[model samples]
Target: MAAYPENNRTWQIIHNARKGGYAVGGFCVYNAEGVLAVIKAAERCRSPAMIQFFPWTLHFHGPAFIKYAAEVARAASVPISIHLDHCLKPSDADLALECAFDSIMVDGSMYDEEGNIKYVKSVVDRAKDKGITVEAELGRMEGGEDGLPTIDLESVFTDPDMAADFVKKTGVHFLAPSFGNVHGPYPAGGAEKHWRLDRLEKIHAALGDATPLVLHGTHPLSDEMIRVGMARGMVKVNQNRNVRNGYHEYIAENCTKVELTTLQVEAVEAYSKGVERLMVEVFDSAGKA
Candidate 1:
């Protein structure tokens, strides 16, 4: 098995990724294709990155899938972090950590305040022993993910004060607090375009400079919004939907007379450029590796 990052803390890697002036890409993977696409992009850019999966998808791919992906990433010359995203159950959290994931995110923000704190603390204790970084959600996400239902502004907002307390109590290394972000693509002409940047800034201030904040469901937002998010302490930005859509679109546009393998390579190449563009232009992370 490959060794974990020398830091052994996801926050340290992301804090460096942020101070280095480039947002760390947390690409969500469902299968080998997703993992391959992300790693290739990171390597081509000569940057450090993260690959993660929603726990619901883990049921289909199995926990062994993370181990396989970790080994593949370990063989790469660039630094890579493997993470389990939005794990709701303790068993799932324990399994991912045992499988040697560098980070585990226990997303219990949908629960009430007491429930959220309790879950975060329990997972933190479990993950700490294994030298795995833990991330706890402070706010509820707007759109559905992992079969969870969508939440609106009234339902999904995170209390800045509560978020600070949650982080302190749980001793989580990273925080994924929702600020008008969703799980799926954003709606055209919706409030998502104008994300709650001020709210996010406030949350960052409450959490202080030490804890890195992750931005979830950032695909459909505009470049300006994404850049603002990075400046406001969003060290890690999740960008799975954009990658999937870009890859699929390229294959469909160019596969008229090509074989499946050719189309697959073409999609990979296209997605690589697409990811590179986002990292270099929007995230300003071209040479921060």
Candidate 2:
């Protein structure tokens, strides 16, 4: 059995963080090195953190990787949750549950309101039986991450009324509503377009404090914006672009002289450093475990 079961502590981690005025960072990783980097950073900072795997990551690494991540989470000094991020299908959610993932994000935002709710409810019903937490997105986010398509920003910002109704009907533990955030990098000189706290606050007001909010595509937001968002109930922030960039930068800078074995070590160190900064500096989650 896992040290921290998804159904119980995973939900608590977000709720506690929100109540205590801190935001936990959800770091996405594709390989063992990336996993180690996130766990090591969380351990060093004593932060409650989450290691997330996207749909493509599961396809690339297989179900065995989830067990590997569970082992890492078990061994870590601080609390860690193994989460399946951006799962689009019920089968994918079932696979993650079968692999013992602590939490799963069911992304049915591509569909209309009724369709999204039905899809998310199906996953939630299954997950609840096994004690897993479900996160569902309400509005479509523009720009793609991990091969997903870019949606139009104008039509996709989440509505507060719709958000409240969605949560009530779906029984999702966390909500990822599109305020203005997108996946991957922001357009050049367009950082302002990526975050809208007024919209976020409205959602918070509608949903109230009990349901913790999640921020996806947070890599491009400034630290102040992140702080502002968290202050209004954003409990989990997903960061991938910076971590991947840091890992690649380190490997590119030193791969010529380093042995292949050393490359992995260097990548872990680089990724860990970036994750550490995000936890300790940006999210203010360090030492909150």
Q: RMSD in angstroms, all models?
A: 2.9, 2.4
Candidate 2, 186-205: lDDT as tens digits: 77755476577789899999
Per-residue CA lDDT of candidate 1, range 1-289, in tens? 3343336745556877867867888888777777788788888887778888888666787877878898998887778888888888777776776775889888886678888888888888877778788877887776776555666656467778988888888888889887777777667754445477789889989987678888887757678777878888888888777767788788778888788788877787777777777777787766666
Instruction: Tell me the spans in candidate 1 whose CA falls farther than 4 Å from its real position.
Output: 1-6, 191-194, 253-257
Among these predicted structures, which one has the highest TM-score? 2
> Which segments of candidate 2 are over 4 A away from where they belong?
1-7
Q: Number of backbone collisions per candidate, in order?
A: 0, 1
lDDT against the true structure, per candidate, is 0.78, 0.84
Task: Give the deviation of candidate 2 from the true structure as CA RMSD.
Answer: 2.4
